[model samples]
Target: MSEQNASAAVNIDITRIMEMIPHRYPILLVDRILEFVPNERAVGLKNVTFNEPHFQGHFPRFPVMPGVLIVEAMAQTAAIMVVQTLGKEAEGKLVYFMTIDEARFRKPVVPGDSLHIHVQKTKQRGPVWKFKGEAMVGDTLCAEAEFSAMIMDN
Candidate 1:
């Protein structure tokens, strides 16, 4: 098999994700992608740190990771799944979250915690894709949502 086939068959790292997705610093919520199964499922990681851009305005003294950013992290992970599945064709394309449904925040995410994000593709029709996403830290669930997005060329 080729390198592309191997990537599709196994877990992907930060470098591979960076090559597919256009998100950069301050916006790239996912730190690394652990596993991907084409259109079926994917796992990603985000390391919460005190130095993140949101920490400055989210709180002054007791900084807590914002729920929206957490959701964005999940979205980024989902984007990785789609991009990896589509391969090089995903470059220069933007994946916009069309809807966020059934979102639940169970716990507060703070600095020094490595959030494990898991996403599974629930459905796909033409340009739109629906995903079920969850974020966890150890045994505790931090956030979860069912969202949809449409891929657009940028």
Candidate 2:
């Protein structure tokens, strides 16, 4: 990230994340925001655990966090960036997926991994925004995708 961008980002915890988005419990994939720079980019955290609901059937013997959920986590992080950019104007609005592209899983995200999600804005036209994202476990890449979402009235 450039110095100009870095200067604008602010860190947020789970309590503030809950205040920013509507997800909760097992569905709230993001644990924290390490960097959030309004319209530019965001970095999120997810501490994977064995107790997650997906582990029950995702694989009985060897469990792995589903690739789709990782994408969702990235999307949620991007959604927070959008909300943070828009401030109070974003309240009561919902971020809905419009498209997902170039999605790939480089490595399986397993239990006890700490997922670091990085998302950057590609474009924004009206209520629709496009973003590219990567999910990683430390320095190892776990998954990546480019997706679009429409922020609409809830």
lDDT of 2 by residue, 17-110 (tens): 8888889998999998888777889999999999999999999899999999999999999999899889988966899999999999999999
Error of 2 at 6 (Å): 2.7
lDDT of each: 0.88, 0.92
What digit string (tens of lDDT, one per residue) describes model 1 on residues 1-154? 6654353435567777788788888888898888777777888999899999888887978888999888999999999889888878887699999999999999999999999998989999998999999999988999999999999998
Q: Each model's TM-score? A: 0.90, 0.95
Clashing pairs in 1: none
Name the weakest run of 10 consecutive residues (lDDT summed) in model 2.
2-11
lDDT of 2: 0.92
- Clash pairs detected, candidate 2: none
Find the candidate with the highest lDDT and give its number: 2
